[model samples]
Target chain A: MKFNHRHVLSMEQFSAADIHAVLDTAENFLELNSREIKKVPTLRGRAVINFFFEPSTRTRTSFEIAGKRLSADMLNLSGSSSSVVKGESLVDTALTLRSMNPDIVVVRHSHAGAPHLMARHVGAHVINAGDGQHQHPTQGLLDLMTVRQRFGQIEGLKVAIVGDILHSRVARSDLIGFQKCGAEVWLCGPPTLLPPEFARFGARMTYNLEEALTGAHVIILLRVQAERMNSAFFPTAREYSQRYGLNSEKLKWARKDAVVMHPGPMNRGVEIDPSVADGAHSLILRQVENGVSVRAALMMMLLGGGDRPRGDA
Target chain B: MSAGVREPVQVMNRRDFGRALDRLAHEIVERNQGVENLALIGIRTGGAFLAERLQKQIGKIEGVKPLLGIIDITLYRDDFANGLSNPVMGPTEIDFSLAGKKVVLVDDVLFTGRTVRAAMDALMDHGRPTRVQLVVMCDRGHRELPIQPDYTGIVAQTTRSENVKVRMKELGEEDGVWIEPPRPRTLPVAVLPPPAKERSKRKK
Candidate 1:
């Protein structure tokens, strides 16, 4: 199982074996993360540039920590801070960064295929941090790692992803990733938020949140993309909370050992109840902690010769 | 010998392997002057198994168990950028501090000494040891780095290109040391493209 892809732009690019490689490598990094001196000299003398054209907290910090931990010289440039705000073309910016000879370029943009465009222009390996509503591959990977840590294996488990699937890059990536691992994926939200087209992706779609949560091993709550929504997707926040939001009452619909997850910057009252978010079943913080390990594994694969075939001794 | 395949010449049998380990374990204990504050850190895969066996052997002799740890040198390899294939990473478990302990770095086979260099650097990251000693079951002669094993079980002279395998029972192999000849390289079958004149004729 060679992780031959130089640039990780989507979960669609990952086969089951390739996903295993990432997860397996991340497992080692998870151990490294728990070390007293949580750092490795793997990517020494390598340069990494985190170019985020959108706002992020967890993703940016995770990538930064991962690079620093691997001993890679890291440079972070945000949309407001960089020349992207000055009307510099994406290709020109990428070319300029390429001239500086960064070994890895992590891109986060509001537009879809932005990282793909960056990869086309830059010689450095490109990792799509999050490209609009298209894909957040690393987040999907950490979620997989978190679930795998809890359950040991991903096969034959029901994963229910609730809320705003239409405006979520996480939804797209997780749907592909979980299904690839042989998990039955269920998408549940309001009709406007959950499209029937998602069913084409081999996920079971349900308007009733209770039905989706029923017999679920893992439940992932997506943040309502209020910023992306232009019109009313639901009657009100209160009504949506009562219908689709995962509170203590709705939690009973799932199995006794059912674990809950949320891609962070979560709407506490609107999307999930605070009690459930901080409950025993919640793996939200564990997912955040695994983010660094997963990103470190990605950097090691792309820059540390992890993806290449073994050369003769 | 078959085409592109090399046969291994067995140098040590299962009894020889056990005797070598028993001797190596005794030597490590004698050199360190008792097992107090002595920790054994093994390199991953083969070295890890050898370290475990040595730990038990030493415990039986000295009537006290030493602290044991395992270090994976895949991250610390200088050949990382040189396109060495991604080695499957195992957990590096150094739970105890190396601050005051006499660390015995154990390995199965010492060839390039590059692995030892990486292992030492990896060990330092955990904590600085009082003193570090190297121990190996087999020391096949090929030193890329200026590093030498302090306590060697067997020293074998071999060409740089030869492969020395230390098969262990723990890794699902019979205990033995074998010198394997390099595999014969197969000639690549070249595929010639059609001539330009033939291509022009095909267009008609």
Candidate 2:
């Protein structure tokens, strides 16, 4: 289907076929990766804007790379670098950018569904990079794509997503994507972080790190938000790590070929042990690399071009 | 018989068609000297099946299995919203490592180059490959994007009013290529205005 001029707001809208389509396109993209000229003029005249309210080096760069590779003109506007510090409201900033007549906007905001709100005001297609703790759909998709690449499929694989769950948008999006792909999901964190009603999504909740890690084909380590400590949610980083950290010994309980993953920037010794992060089983870097491919695929599909014909709105 | 109706016709037979795949496979190996750092990724359905066959043929000639992957390219397609209902997703399989490897994009046909364009966008999610080359079973003439196939099994010159169909034995009963005329475009229904008396009564 034609993906041109579409807004990607959440994983809730994705179907199994949509997931398969993106993965299939990404495969063809891998084939195109060998040329000396790593760019195509598909979106040459199109303008894309990257509006990041939150601090992110990896996601922002991945979106920028995807735009540039497609030969689209990309503009990066971070809160610190933009007019937001100069007293520009989110809506005002969105309006100002909308006046520029961009073809697509990739937005990462501190508030949940900010991209959705921005979509209402702008004529360009909106991509939700991350909004508060609401959702990071692209990250979730890339994570799923990475897992699928390694495992050949996502059906019935036991996945343990450990660490901060309550305040993590990545966790929320990951849960949806993993479940949609037919994997059995488990949410493990401190009781305070793990919500009581997570069973609604068919995920098993746990406080014991050992039990959670056992027999899991994939172990997703979420970075513990240090700011959560200020609220007295957890006593200290060291204490939390001792109880929940994914150390080499703890990883032993997981499947032998279990792939370790984390959304960066990693806290090294906080959420996950250093040995495990750097271990042979770690697919952390692969996840980052896949982020670009997945984002590029998303941009292309959402922007325009695919198997299906463009619809008349 | 309607004034605008036309019949579809067979284009290429099995013997001539097998030669095309064989030639394309030879060209791929000749260009790369082997399939060592290269990968073959096909679009879903037909392209994917073709990629698997090419991998087998290339393996026989070069003694190496080129890394194979299948892309659904649906969510990434530009016209995703045109359908009446939400599209169903399919399996995307790429088992080998994509890091720093040369990739060969395989497809059953190359028409407007839009599919290849979408494929490129999807490829970035996996990893950065060292290089990428386009390989198609049929390069039907109709250039919408600035894309050219590096290796083509058959370069068929056809009009925009004609459709090219490549059927593989794995997915279909017959392994052959067919050319068919395009279906007639339907006109949209025009909305009629309300009656003058009813419009005036509403205003009053």
Candidate 3:
């Protein structure tokens, strides 16, 4: 199949082959890391905009790195820093950016489907970094890539995703990604945080932390959104951590090869015990590192440089 | 089926294959300064196996283990809907850090560049890398996307009708390369010219 111009707004839009193409291209791009000159001129003449309506450190930085590596001129527009304070609507903001003739626009918004809406109005390729709790397709792919790299294959791997699944876009994206990549996904959290319909996606639901971790091949711990506590989902942070926290003792229930991962801004003592988060099995840092390569791959593909191979071959 | 033409199947032997991988490894190390702050990611199936081999060779030469990642670009392909009844996903492995690291993307062959496009989508969730370079065993040409291989072992010029097959001992039973000629399609035989007499009789 041929991909000329396309917008990536959701994980649902990807087919198995589509996913394979992105992964394969990223694999080839990874080779660039070993070079003395890390930057490539593939997307040098292209322009990219990082439109983030939500505050993010990891994601924003990753997209910036990806754009810079591809040699595309990058623009960072944050809601707080931009003219949104002057009363510009998202549609207007997107239209203004589109007028700038960008080759790609990476968006992170607080509203679900915001990227989808923006994509309809833009000539540039739109990449959804995160949208509310709906989906983070790129995050899902990178998480799957991380897990697969640790383990030879994802088939039949027992993966337990714990913490605030209710407000986690990462959880939702990882759920889809893990299941699609052949991993058995398990969702564990308080009843309020764990939706009843989660099982429909082929994931096993559990409220007990120990049981969820039992013999699991991979453990993905999502960051607990403290702001969501205002709704009385959990009584207190300490109480919540006691019931569902992944500590050293609980870590023993997972398989020997079991690895623990977290999407950053980690609450050291809340969602995961410090010992476990810093332990040898923790791939948390690895996740952060992979985020760059993955984002770079995404930008290259969306900007039309991904399809081209690098160097003087 | 095309007059006197025969389908071609040319083989690339083991010694030549090993040399190809060695050269790729050397190129990767020289480019990235001995694998420090570097990673190797492979496409699923053959690409992943090739990445592992390259990593092993690079590790021996560099004296430091390079992070190896495997990616399955199944959902990122362009022709996904036309191929399968149900999507078949492969594994993606990248245990090492990607942030601020130079990444080498390894694949068996570079053809239409569709696979590399998908692999890029899959790589983003992990983190961000300092850079991404593409390495392939064979550059078969005729790329649909603007993608170009950074480090290509061999540049084999092939027609659109030709098929390139890469076999590795880790994934396949043998290690070799084969080029096969495209098969021509036969036209459907006319059944009595659609019964012209019947059509005229019906008209009468």
Candidate 4:
């Protein structure tokens, strides 16, 4: 009930209390996910539509599974399959989907405010899956869940996000989301990819990866997002790996219990070493697992009973 | 329980609550024939605490402990779309398998029979038990489903307008049951009774 947002557009909309409410709800779903019979009849008659204007495997499949586990009728629409390929406008597409009467809409788009635009046109609760360098709210929430589960708290913890901050929507969401939860956020990458203006976002910007990794509780390595970048930001992949990539040696710079994380489609050897990606300290896979639960919690709150008037009253 | 109106008529004091559970425990042992493969699974929040107490009472009587579990039936409720104002979820902990076991589902109150229905559905999803029984501390009935408690502690005849409040020691309230009478006609109705026709149909 504390999380009474009509739509999950960005982490900016979530206050510290709202974030905690979501993470607490997600804890229940995490237990459900561990069950032998994971399916629940919470959203039996409701319909959820996943409209991805961009290509995705982990996020798309995660949402699909989350919806199905709740017994919701799930419809997946990809860029190649939808009439957007036939020249339909985003608003027109949203209106077209609106006619089908979905209860919730999960959207991912290449445009920055595409989810916002969809939210404007549709009555269904709109959740931003990801928008072009704008936000990936659920990803931010799942990362928060992972960190909270590991550290048992988020306040006063040092979270270092490494790699291409310029084009990564995950970075933007994590920066705002983590800071909202009272975590010290540090951004590290090459100077071109990590700008000085990022300091205005209340995060400590660093060109030297060691400075960011030192004494950090969480180290999140971001994907390069080459598709979002038109020109080269770094000279070579080898040079970037040698300098910024988190290997066994680089991992030692953090606290003894420091955990490594990645918003995946991980270029195994680029932003992070494969050993670290598959290491005991890695929460990358846990992030994916928590993704399903966090998303399910969001859908349940928005559609189930978060806004229902008290029948007893 | 919703706040505001007062004048609580005490139905069962703390001593009566203890005595009812004692009798309910005896009946359960007699019916189930010495707690062989028996499991007590309580519905969350209220029933969960009752289940734990029942487990202790049953253990004291039989000289053995029955399997215990706690279930949150929020996810399986019939009115997920509207009935509950804020659905706060709890953990459904059933560590042992329910197969071939005589499971007794416990709750604090039995109202519309909908919570029992939801609990049964949730129980099935965990695993099918050989036999399942219902137990309630209070059966203030307005039966909407074809369900009845196998072992009941207190059966109070309550009006549709009156709300039954079961305060337990676990929740920092003295163990007792109180009936809250309907609000005055000048104020808007708090808990509305079901239509007369539906009530008659339920009785049938």
On DockQ, the leading prediction is: 1
True-vs-predicted CA distance for residue A3, candidate 4, Å: 2.3
lDDT of 4 by residue, B77-117 (tens): 88988736567887778887788899999999999999999
Tens digits of per-residue lDDT for model 2 on B89-162? 46567766677988888889899998899888777766788888998888887888999999877777677777
Instruction: Evaluate model 2: give its lDDT.
Output: 0.81
Model 1 ranges off by over 4 Å: A228-230, A306-313, B1-7, B186-204
> Can you list each candidate's DockQ?
0.48, 0.11, 0.05, 0.40
Query: How well does candidate 3 match the true structure in TM-score terms?
Result: 0.63
Q: RMSD to native for every prediction?
A: 3.9, 7.3, 11.0, 7.2
How high is the lDDT of residue A215 in model 4?
98
- When summed lDDT is taken over every stretch of 10 residues in candidate 2 chain A, the lowest stretch is A304-313
Model 2, residue A297: what's the lDDT?
70
True contacts kept of 2: 0.02
Shift in Å, residue A220, candidate 4: 0.6
lDDT of 1 by residue, B53-81 (tens): 99999999999988999999988988788
Q: Assess the local accuracy of residue B168 in candidate 2 as a C-alpha lDDT between 0 and 100.
A: 76
Which lDDT tens digits does candidate 2 get at residues A1-313? 5333367888887886677677766655554455444675556767889989888888999899888887789998888999999998877887888788887789999999888888877767788999998899988988898899999999999999998898899999999989998998999999899998778988988999888888999999998876776687788998988998888988999999999999988888888888999999999998887787787777666555322211111
Docking class of 1: acceptable
